[model samples]
Target: MRTRQRWPILVAATLLVAACGQESETPDVDQNAVATTSCASSGELTMWERSGGNKAMVDMLVEAWNTKNPDCKIKLTYIPHTEMVGKIAQGIASGEVPDLMGMDLIYAPQFEKAQQLVDLTDRIKDWPELKTASKGHMTVATFEDRLYGVPLYADVSALFYNKDLFQRAGLDPNKPPTSLPELRAYADKITALGGDVKGYYLPGNCAGCNIFTVGPLMWASGAKIEAANKGDEPLVGDGVKQVLQFTRDMVKAGNVHDGDRAENGETFHLQFGSGKVGMMGTGNFNITLAREQNPKMNFGVALLPGMTAGSSASFIGGDLVVVPKGSKRVADAVNVMKFLLSDDVQVEVYAKALNLTTRSDMVNNKYFQAEPLVQDVAKALEVGRTPYTLTFFEQINSPQGPWLKMLQRAYYSDDSLDTIISDAKKEMKAIADQS
Candidate 1:
């Protein structure tokens, strides 16, 4: 959740006045002098966030802040997820960074290492409200024994199926696939329909999404990115190979699309919406887009299929709010963080934005329970895992990343499972070494 709106000048002036006069013991200085002086000198709190459909939620929070603290002003900026890291790095180097900003959990460690983020550990420890918040997500925000940010949203992947397509394939619409074998069987049945239709669809170009959705397939098989001591080479385990081969099988079976058209921005939702795909692995956000695109389509969501060795474990992704080092408004930013974590605001913002809540206590809040898919996503959060380390973002997103290339080769080329996996291990080793 990020924004691009300009800072509120009035709010800054108000905060400045409160900061200056709250410490004054002089009876000679008029309150108006405090207000005017503070207004004239107070700087705006600039914040940067991702530009999605969640702008309204940020606006509502800022509005609420202004209502409660009329003197503090906030400036908002919107940065796309793709450019957030680069822009923030440039801003930090120039000493012109914002007071507050939203960062992805995967990339937060880099900022923390750069010494550009404020340590919120003390505040978080003292604040009971934040302590009981989403401990799972907060784990990502904490690094090197200090908390650097507060998670703002929770996102987890789940299986979304076309109920109508399931019924057409002679499957029960009410019973979604719950295991890997069952999912594969259902996909085969759906593909048998044959007229421009697919059993499943996942974008070959989406490395991050694949990690969130397809990565689970490997985890379900009990494989992981191997970690080793000293100079030992990290390797992909058996489960990793199994999932990679599974993806290869899906592409070869005509159950999924792998052409250049799919590579050029064709989303899984579009294929599912058009009745060309019967099922997809997606996050909760996809539900909104799918409903908007095809109101008449019948769909149901369920937990990702479990593997023989591994339980269903999806990847969790979300944004975190951080205070920059040396920010003049560190105290105020902490206050805002606490407010955002408050039960009332968390519920309000999550209710309107349709994003999952990071607070454990808020998981069963009435708002989330009202929607079936959202409820499934909330449950998925209980069992989800993030990439093992912060470097996971760069490792997977870089041009030479193993995940993207592995996915592409599997989908677009005739490379065998062995070759693709051998190449992936080398790439993963390089990434681990760099880290």
Candidate 2:
């Protein structure tokens, strides 16, 4: 019999707060007392993770810990992908939160502000291996000068093109398009083949995926959400308008498909696997799914096309493991964190999960060397940058969320590019004011 799933109430609260821009104060901890207590042992720890492949990986980690420690055991909870954030929030609010959690990078900042997380700075300062294993992702897990979590895995978006589609379109399969104009030319060629084929497929519902897909386009074009504050003079100017307009153009050209409305990363993969789409902006997970669904599907991964800058950068998104602020087993938690970061575990877990590793040492491991898709992902990682602020969830879900809608509308409608961008900028300024 299947068990009933309980949604964490705190997650609902988080979603509400994220969407509405409400702030929740972190529970106060007596730092002096917490610092003096040694790590506890033999306590039952609860860990929550998303289902399917991700769940399998967390389970493997738990098993390894249990076999070696014997004294400490973890109870694993599988949360549906759609409900993970809400359930995690519910768990936190009820004081029944998991001892450790595997969370997406987008939610890290929100959790950090709530003081729901324990600072791992002191622990990491002495552990060279853990520091080395983080592969620059620690920056994402940090907020206000405090380290809140240890990265479990890292990933970035890339263009996955069907080699067969490229060849059929009279393009070299070995050399995928590297710039926007080139991509448009190649995609047009693919679409010309007709019959339910689209040049590109990107999800419209998944905002997180959009950050990876569309955000990079803006960055490549020398645009950003805003300019860095170097004592006055705002950095963001007209470039933002230009990038949004470009996305609108892609939509207008029919290069992007409507199928994204009901699908997500997995559904997008199924579509791509069937040869219905020629190119997609997706993550490493798609490589595995594509291989399983159609072993003969000729596909190659490439960095997302560049703009005038002639360079590409992707928004990195993945999971990190953090100990809650009130956990009694801080030492043991640190120990487990260390083990997870070890080279042996990084390669083993990455091999099984097929996710990218955070360590530089693991980039050239035999597993990645054997898979061209993985290798491409590693190459893209070299140019990766996380979103500028931890309020990413709020930034994406707010009234500014209309920017995304505007992009889709501009793409699908006859609206002028300037109108779409001007409207989006107005909305963006409103959201920034709230921050």
Candidate 3:
């Protein structure tokens, strides 16, 4: 979940104050205290989740949960992604917060660090399934070694290639690019087919698109963009230049779609979906969207590769099921979360619907066993990573952020890659320091 909503300073300050103020009225929770809620607890709990493709899955799961536990029901509200943060802030300030919320995992660190979420370390620490859950989501939800949320679903990034185009270009459709040099070589071969078909596509103007799709390339090369620990300074490593140079070379060689520089993510997959672009990097959500755009188009997916061969990674992104602090229905909310994470719901409701399960252990379920693309995604869920920084939006996802600026200069201009990376690093360092 990369979203366009950048939290302003005022709202951030409001959330800090509201969360801290609520903490005063509520007694400090014992670090070892375990919640008494069971999966069968009978009560009503309110929850909020963002509206999008996941809405159908969420609604279906809630209905199933209600059917399973007639005595314990959930009232879920669908809020727009742009309005979620502000609404949550207002809810906290007015004491009108929901019992639980399924929020973007990227924002979990912010809420957890600010004490806006309930600590569930004691309750979830001993659960066997926790060992197999997606590490990226769990890492984002944890603050100071305490768990605050459970993964709701997974959205990982991967390279999508047009299978038909590969065959037409005399390339093996069964074997996709596994490394950066292979990707460039594949692109050159595809571009030589001559026509509107280019070798690759890029959403040049969308910051979210770049971070979600390109971030993993840097990570796969063993680069750490965000600090692993709170007190450590975040560093933009040399792998960034490798990614920038690769993209710039592709663009200069006319291997990328000409319209890519103007794409703002609204039609990110359309060019590739039209069967004109040979490959593109995007999230798992696009598998459905692209198919819907052109039902006859043939595509294949693989984990995005690093600079070297045999290296692969993905940006692990999705929603987390969190119990907001100050809720009277904590027991019921915890019970609902537990029920959702169970094997039955995870397999039947989520995997059956072609959605990635939050738990990696469910990858071998019948649904994933039937789809090879999903199997690749399952592997990504197991190894993909996400930044746990508190200023993710300001530093990476914002339209005016340093990450986007760096991409624009490096990919769309003739500017020196070294200078672009250096300037961006200073800007990122300043933002991280302020946080």
Candidate 4:
């Protein structure tokens, strides 16, 4: 969900040509080369990764791989997450795609369906290590019962609370809200503190912020913003209305920051990190960032609550490592993926950095156990879900898309809730059908 770039529609014609290269007589590409389960004995590899928190982790893995096998060295390039999809699309069009690419999971279906990703179903299906990977990400990486990628790292949304704010407000620091009613009550209590302090904060102008954070509330209560099956309409259940109403109520109560309505995600986390906000909905990457920004700030993390007390969910947002269709070093790229998934990297590297590992079994490692905040997020990642749709970027992640329009109207506008929901379903349905 940290991905903020606007991506253009992947030209269907360009992808078709990229998947099946031109009939050039040049020897650079082998027309008959195809993805295989076997690993190359030696080769050079090029991989493009998204920048941000994940950059250091990718760099470490690449260095380790190069040290282990100098013959199969990987040349890594950092691309802004915002520019990743469009750049990849352009790369495909120019027949210059990377051998390995770490992409946002939401775009997996789009590329997989376009035949621009290499199928690794047979390669990883029986690999014993595959059983330990995040099942949620694996679901997003699959299309038509075939695998195209593996989880590179995970970033799921959860509720972040300021412990000091809670204690100063006379609320128990250890006890965070677990339901919609409790959340509102907590927000009101915190907001009562007055003077530059706010009970809750959300990047009102950020579609990714709302969807990755607010979306879990709807999902925990059994609602959906996108259809699971292609061509089906989105199921905007009572949960959806309830979540929207909850946000509207919070706004009306002045429990949210006055400036939040105009704030985008660019500095939302920093505001929370400043120690004024009582609660915020954001991703796990902030766990380390919050500490770095304010070393003394006592914070707690928990799953995003549902309408009721006992239910919770999170947005399973992260990058997936995929080998492009025309990659000449598919085997070498996959070998890198395997090395990354190994426990040595998943636990020692990622978990030690206060990040969630792609493998669920590694959640209880020594590093996570030592940090309750990280542990709580690890639990959220297991139960989180990523929306499965080819039009995810266009219909939801896009700033100008209908999803943001509906979300804006739901919270800030004077429109009726019924009208907002109705219009949203229609717009989402139209986009879903286009896929």
Candidate 5:
């Protein structure tokens, strides 16, 4: 859920927002045994992970890593999720880097292009857990035919609704809308039951969040924004425009929060967490945060509504841990990967943390089977795809990127839908064609 999940942004100047964890540090020395990609011996390993939502869980694992293999002595530091990737790219040039980086999948290709990460294609095949990794998770880190990162966990977007609101509106809590028109109707129904609560949490700004928010709608509509990781341009077809138009109509209906247009997605987390919003397109991780934030709030999750009833799609996102080329402990990093992908660690993530695991094999775990919200995520992942391509990283994810700009206009502009789609397709293709 790299691009698709909501990370609490820490830095105001950049898109640096995400919930994270804190940790210890390590040193640089000649790691003579680094050639052994096995976990038999010990060596100092340094790693950097993004901070926010998943921080505590990750910290728990890191603590276990240090204690379980004291000789390996792996030390970690939490970089603001916003700062992790950019800083690491800078670190590559400055020659100051960590042994491993738990990074967003969308950026892997860029690092690979810069020669900042070590390709684990050969080393990765040796790991059995890899076969369980989902296509969306692997799609982010794969460039051409090689893998550069091991997905630590996964995130998928879903339609999250306030069960209380649904019941009050006379809607069935067990049954959620599965098409865009039905979703719109539900939003209107919830809104009609006047209160401080809004029917839907729509984003007027923040393209960074929309990658999964509205992005899922486009995918569900059978729109191919582009080829998996490379293409001449994103296919801004009728489906994409319909999604934008649907949002526009909803915004016109005042189904969203009062100040939704002015803020980026970061605010929705607080709103949804507090029970002010009824429905929001969100990742699996938010299930825990919502409960912790408002224990009284009852929530239900379902597949994001598609264009056609029963049709489903979601954007899979999450961090992929990669080894930077400068790190001497490549072997130790492999060991770290081994432990991370193990049943002990992943089971905790799915069962206790209620977060999505990168391994598809965990889909049937009794934990997810028991939790409806987590199950919604698993179902989404089974059919989910990542909105990544090997090109135009800046124009897509950047604050000033073309994709965000298109969304900004789509949600806020007075222009016609056809005009917006036409202009957006041109801009996207222009940026995509860049070197």
Candidate 6:
């Protein structure tokens, strides 16, 4: 949780075309083309991966696969996130893409459009464990109903509340807020404790902060900013505006931490660590940090409240494993995808990184059963969503994206929620049309 891994600004991916023309067979390669012959004899499987602050996870997976499957060797190379898109684009254009690649889920569709990936749609759904995958995970990995990548693991967001703060505020510790209105009311109660005890904190200056925090409110209110497909209708109601209004009212009420508006990832979590901050909307990893910082801190978890009950949502983060379209070793690459998604990999990876395993079956693991924080987190993962869309990098997360623009207007300017949201809708619609 204290991991200060800051992501540099992500870039918009240029649409890719599939790799064409097969490379001549080399030493250790079968002479018959994989398209003409079975790829069972395919030699070393070369893969490209982004080092998302967890290189060991990649190392462990590759080592495990190589040990067990001697015939299909996996060779992985790390590409910095800032350089991955340009490198992949060049590789695709040159028709020399790797056998498999690991990438952020948001960029998968842009690559898929270029026919730059192996079609995994037929293989992925049949994966019994995948049936338990959250709609958001499945949605992120799919383009035009075709599966393009396998979700490895993801960081999930859930509500973290100090039980001590709840007791002090006279709010029932067993019954946390279940609706957005209740969140404000409960937060106001906790905020009444003046000195250093803030009711809540939402990271404003942080890039991609809203996806896990306010984005869930929009989802719970049954709204989405972007359409999944062209000609699909925009979010039907005023849910987006409602989330904005709730946030604005909280600011006026002074429930948010004093310096919260200026906080990035590090400072935001530090507020919760001080033990006086009553509630925080952040990722599960923060729990580890809170305990490490204050051993006696008694905290609990709940879903991020929506407009109504049973409407909670979460933002899931992590990488997806994919196969490049140019690979002659499709069979072995597909095998690697399976191994990455297998229950064993999910559990082992979680041990090292504490990232929530995306698999539904892993909920039964004894580790989660005994760990209340992780158990609650696993529940959220069952419904967690990715901040993914075609052009997602440009429309939602990049410097000029609408989400950041909307936040700045709502917080730093005199713009009313109505005008801000109306403008956002138009920007989002234009992006959708371009898609």
lDDT, candidate 5, 165-216, per-residue tens? 8999999987889899999999999988887778888766666577777888
Q: Where is model 4 poorest over a 10-residue stretch in terms of lDDT? A: 23-32
lDDT of 6 by residue, 1-435 (tens): 112333322333432432333332312233232221113564787889876535666677788778777766788899887677777766866767788888766667666766666677765556776787655667778877888877755667788899999999999988878998898999999999788888887776664666667778888798876654456544447788788888888877888865777665556657677887787778777777899999998899988888886679887776777877566766666667677666776776564455566676776776666677887877777667775556565566655567778876776566877888878777766776767
> Can you write out model 4's per-residue Cα lDDT over 278-317, one digit (the tens) per residue?
9988888888889999999999998899999979998987
* Alpha-carbon local distance difference test for all models: 0.65, 0.64, 0.79, 0.79, 0.71, 0.70
The alpha-carbon deviation from the true structure for residue 112 of candidate 2, after best TM-score superposition, in angstroms, is 1.5
Query: Which has the greatest TM-score?
Result: 3
| lDDT score, candidate 6, position 70 | 79
* Model 6 residue 139 distance off true place after TM-score fit, in angstroms: 1.4
lDDT of 2 by residue, 216-264 (tens): 7776767666321122222255555666566666666778666665443
* Rank ordering of all candidates by TM-score, starting from the highest: 3, 4, 6, 5, 1, 2
Number of clashes found in candidate 1: 13
Can you list the residue pairs that collide in candidate 6?
Answer: 16-114, 17-114, 18-114, 18-115
In model 4, pairs of residues that clash are 5-82
* Residue 294 local lDDT, model 2: 90
Candidate that beats the other on TM-score, 1 or 3, i.e. the better one: 3
Better of 1 and 2 by TM-score: 1
Displacement of residue 15 (Cα, Å) in model 5 is: 19
Model 3: CA > 4 A from native:
2-6, 24-40, 227-235
Q: How many clashes show up per model? A: 13, 8, 0, 1, 19, 4
lDDT of 1 at 251: 74
Compute the lDDT of residue 157 as modeled in candidate 3. Answer: 86
- Model 2, which residues run further than 4 Å from truth? 1-40, 50-53, 80-94, 130-136, 204-206, 226-239, 256-266, 388-391, 397-400
